[model samples]
Target: MRVTTQNGRVLLQNDVVNAAPVISTSELRGLGMESVAYIRAVEVEGEAGFAIHAADGTPMAVTEDRETAINAILQHEMMPVPLH
Candidate 1:
């Protein structure tokens, strides 16, 4: 198991190919689900849109609509989490 931190969050990287590794909640704020992402509503240049970001808060992409943003995240094998 490899552990790294980015943006003050702990990230556990799985090194084993086919072995199932158990992780703790304190280990990852978001789990080992590789492509976890979240969507947020934003106004860019006076245009309403949705913005997709990685678990570490890195900007991924922006879409004009909510459905399209969700689809784009899913297409990339990323889980879209709701932000409050």
Candidate 2:
């Protein structure tokens, strides 16, 4: 798995292709995932938004509301840290 950031958004790249994929950012957090995830406030398409990313810089999700974004991470039982 490869994780990187582009245009202030996190991007995750996986090499393996399978029909039944189980491992995911939400899954990782749901199982008390030990990986570090980051929540960053960003502007995409000229609009304000928030993005969730893994410790290695993999993009998880993005939302327009900060609270919604943070809450989503919390709901998954993961910590959401602000970027910068």
Candidate 3:
């Protein structure tokens, strides 16, 4: 999934559809979901925002803050994958 930064923290892409943000940048450090190179839309309701699964479905993002969460299309690339 696309990744960006707010205050320098590595954040996951909001979403590419509807120009919405995947995760709220308000009181948080990066995304709670695992890391992915892409994003996807899921079928759900409020407080159950959309779902973004990683290539391997390992790193997924989910927000219960609002009814619907939409990520933007323009996004920044993530830093070179860090070596664990």
Candidate 4:
């Protein structure tokens, strides 16, 4: 995803998907706070795991398996965004 800002609004373009998702400042402020979650790799006491967090960076859950983490987010009716 390619992120850029225009007039204080954030623009996200996915090259592979060939789509642009626009988020205004107001919308950006609420991103991940609802309806969306993020997945990222983390180190848990020297063990690797996938950490799930709300869009606003609030910790939600952690799982040893990536697929499990994704499914958990989906089961919550949230869109899962994986961060590398």
Candidate 5:
């Protein structure tokens, strides 16, 4: 039997499948507040902008520049992932 990981799930050539990995609340808490964040382009109040949000969905900042938004998250020591 051959096992491999794909998209956080385990797959076996013998026709077995494992569920996606899960993160516990305690484990997330241990990572400290706002350890991760997402940067997304958005239009708000009739203006186009980029927004940064914390892992818990809290709004961090909004700016007219995408790079500025991402850099702001990095300045806070948080991992920033761009959202399409």
Candidate 6:
């Protein structure tokens, strides 16, 4: 629902969920480039979750599930624009 930087600076912060991803690290990383960090509020089987991904879709970490996942996502301090 919200996107912010690692330093707590917000970019495209929002209270509601986004139907589509703000950005996909997997696609960008495939181009042989790497930078920044990002996380997303994802849904699986109608459940809410979060995925911590590097600029290249390599998961740095992922939350357990539901609130735990959301909490973990909240801690993301995206170092670059990708994360925001």
Error of 3 at 62 (Å): 2.3
Per-residue lDDT for 1-84 in model 2, tens only? 777876565667787675344365555666654545688888999999988887557789999987888788878877766567
Tell me the whole-model lDDT of each prediction, alpha carbons only.
0.81, 0.74, 0.40, 0.82, 0.75, 0.55
* lDDT score, candidate 6, position 9: 37
TM-score of each: 0.62, 0.53, 0.25, 0.60, 0.62, 0.33
Report how far off residue 74 is in candidate 1 (Å): 0.5
Which is the better candidate, 4 or 6, if ranked by lDDT? 4
- Candidate 3 lDDT, 1-84, residue by residue in tens: 677777766667654565644344333235422232344444465343545334334444554332222242113222112113
lDDT of 6 by residue, 8-66 (tens): 43356666565543444445566533545566767757766677666666676656554
The parts of candidate 3 lying over 4 Å away from their true place are 1-35, 46-49, 63-84
In model 4, the worst 10-residue window by lDDT is 17-26
Clash list (residue pairs), candidate 6: 6-77, 6-78
Which segments of candidate 4 are over 4 A away from where they belong?
A: 1-32
* Top lDDT model: 4
1-84, model 5: which lDDT tens digit per residue?
678776675555553466454454555667864588897778999999988887767787898998898788888888886555
TM-score result, candidate 5: 0.62
Q: Which ten residues in a row have the lowest lDDT in candidate 6?
A: 75-84
Please give, for residues 12-49, the per-residue lDDT of candidate 1 as tens digits. 77867775554544455666445788999999999999
Model 3 residue 72 CA deviation in Å:
9.9
Candidate 2 segments whose C-alpha is farther than 4 A from its true place: 1-35
lDDT of 6: 0.55
- In candidate 1 the C-alpha lDDT for residue 26 amounts to 49
In angstroms, give how far residue 58 of model 2 lies from its true place: 0.5
